[model samples]
Target: MGEADRIITLPAKLATALHGIAPGLITDTLAFANRFLPDPGGIGEQQMDGKNSETYLSNSLLARLTDEAAEANNEIG
Candidate 1:
C-alpha cells in the first residue's frame, strides 16, 4: 500500500485488533477518520470543528501521528 493508504488505514486496523484482543475496549472515536477525511492531503489544517472534546482531541492526535508517519515514510521511501 501507498503512504496515504497506510496513514488512513492504520488506525482502524489497530482499533480492530485491540477490540479483538479485548472486546468492547475500543470506541468508535478511535476509528474516526480512518475510512475518510474531509481533507486527506491537508489533514493537519482540516477543521475538526463541531466534534466533542474527546473526539476532537483523539482525532487531533491521530492527525499529528499520521502526518509524522507520512513524513517518515516519504523520507525513507
Candidate 2:
C-alpha cells in the first residue's frame, strides 16, 4: 500500500509495535529538547507560551519519528 493508505489505515498495527517502545524514547526526547527553545514545527500550536510540556513532547516526538520513517521509506522506494 502507498504511504497515504498506511497512514490512514495502519495505526492499529503500528500502535501494537510502537506502544512499549515509546515511553523511554519520549522521556529522553523531551529531556533533550528542553535544553533550548522548542521548534515551531516540533509543536502543534504556534503560540506555544510554554505551559504545555507534555503536549509539546507528544506532538513533537510522534511527528519526528513519523517524518523520519516517511523520509526513509521514500528513499528506499
User: Which candidate comes out best when scored by lDDT?
Assistant: 2
Q: What's the lDDT of the predicted structure labeled candidate 1? A: 0.57
TM-score of each: 0.24, 0.23
**Which pairs of residues clash in candidate 1, taking residues 3 or more apart in a chain or in different chains?**
none
Which digits, one per residue and each the tens of the lDDT, describe model 2 over residues 1-77?
85445554476556545645696775676688787864556555656543234565556866688658768888423
Q: Report the number of backbone clashes for model 2.
A: 0
RMSD of 2: 13.6
Residues 1-77, candidate 1, lDDT per residue (tens digit)? 75345545777777666776876445565456455753343346666643322345556866788658768888423
| Candidate 2, pairs of clashing residues | none
lDDT of 1 at 3: 36
Question: Which portions of model 2 miss their true places by more than 4 Å?
Answer: 1-19, 38-77
